[model samples]
Target: MQEKFVINIGRQIGSGGRTVGELIARRLGVKLYDKELINLAAEESGLSPEIFEKADEKESKGLFPTLMGYLRAPFAGDDGGCTNVLSSEALFQIQSDVIRSVAARESCIFVGRCADYILREHPRAVSVFITADDACRIRRIRNRSGCTEEQARATMARIDAKRAAYYNYFSSRTWGVASTYHLCLNSSVLGEEGSADLILEFAARKLNTKF
Candidate 1:
């Protein structure tokens, strides 16, 4: 109980992974690291946050956009040089450092951005994966995004592909696989509240903590 522990969550798009992570953090009275990580990584790297956000959960696609973005950065050199070249890989390393630094500092829940793999060697790291069936995921996405069924499906595919590509590129383990995580929950079956409760219980048991 002296040392702090961290919960790292990986979820499929529309699986309510973010919601579950928030719930766990609230119940544990700890901070949740999600989009907030982008801000931290931006500060850590001394680059614009927009570049990190744009590269979030994606692989390097091309050079032109990144190059153009560099010229637009306020800190960019007057010579229009790429002193701080930004790419998906570069952004990932920055985020990974932020993840490790924050995890070491406090007990928190990290949703996505490959936090599980980033903190793989942490003594008290708990990793989880949330997944749902196609119908369930599509329904959640439609409800949250107010998009048509086709649009929801498309969004799911796009986001899932990007997340998988990002995780697989940076992690030795594949994303969403049961063996890769300490616990894998079907959010569709458990629902958001139930999923959070189950994960909390799993973490308590895994870490031998009295939560």
Candidate 2:
């Protein structure tokens, strides 16, 4: 078995998934990759981090991203314009590379960005999806964003649609479906810490490791 392992987390916006992933990583003494993938992809691709971030998670609707970003980007050519633009698809590819590279280097927890699919063939990778009931989600969102219940519901719908679209576009599997992941958890049922403990127990058994 491979010494390095990865736990890929798919989370709803207010599900406390990222927080739980952090807890797991801390327990295992491993890094967590989330928005940090943008910086890593930027470094590897020699493009501005802003460019990669704009194309993040969403599927490419066209052949190229707008040149507006390159106008202020340091990498713009001598004519003060972009020499090339990477579509959302291209950026996804680069980010996927960064994901694989990091996971190979050491064990880590990855939050969102379809990491479960990206590392599907890894010898010791575990895939998990997290969800929460509307009440729990509304409370979490209100506390975090100061949004009212209706507004929080709106935000959740908007973001979840985008995430499902992105995941479906890039992978063969469906998002948030039980069959799509090795395990699934309801953050509301167990709360964040309890949910995390259950995940640890499940993953440790699958990975044959102690936590």
Candidate 3:
């Protein structure tokens, strides 16, 4: 029998979280959404994809001026100068709408953007967090990005800080904490394929259905 469910994955940078998501999606014959979500949100909102890309999983920096402009204008000027600015809140709402719509349509894997919290009400949704030790993450980052160890560490710190800030600001729960997820796995300990397999096993058990 085929089972329908949604999987939300929250991952640390260089943890191979996206790779695990892709593997699970393929095994379950479901769509995997990560960067694709930005395009989907852009299409649905009639906004440029670049706008969504810029705001993806990052807090709105230097947006206060634009937000204030929109609040003040409320409508176009006599010269047809549009004062509509896409705030971080607006972008998040649009993406959340897209995420809900897609989840309602079918079972799929959502790689990030706080999908777990967004779909908290879904009965069949399972949320997982993927992380790795600092050394392993640094190594993976260096290899994939062709950076020195110091550069990899810096990159990881910067990206993780952005992700943490985004998640903490938008969601009620704290980011990367074990209590916030149904299951948290260390990709470095298990390896990418092994991590995917474990997630499948856990899902099978939790959902009480075979994959």
**Global Cα RMSD, each model:** 3.0, 3.2, 2.6
Residue-by-residue lDDT tens digits, candidate 3, 164-183: 88898889679999999999
Per-model lDDT: 0.85, 0.87, 0.88
lDDT score, candidate 3, position 25: 96
Best-matching candidate per lDDT: 3
Error of 2 at 118 (Å): 0.7
Residue 141 displacement in candidate 2 (angstroms): 1.0
lDDT of 2 by residue, 65-107 (tens): 5555533464666686546676677678888999999988898
Candidate 1 per-residue lDDT, tens place, 18-40, comes to 99999998998999999999899
Off by over 4 Å in 1: 61-76, 79-84
Clashes of each: 0, 0, 0
Winner on TM-score (1 vs 3): 3
TM-score of 2: 0.91
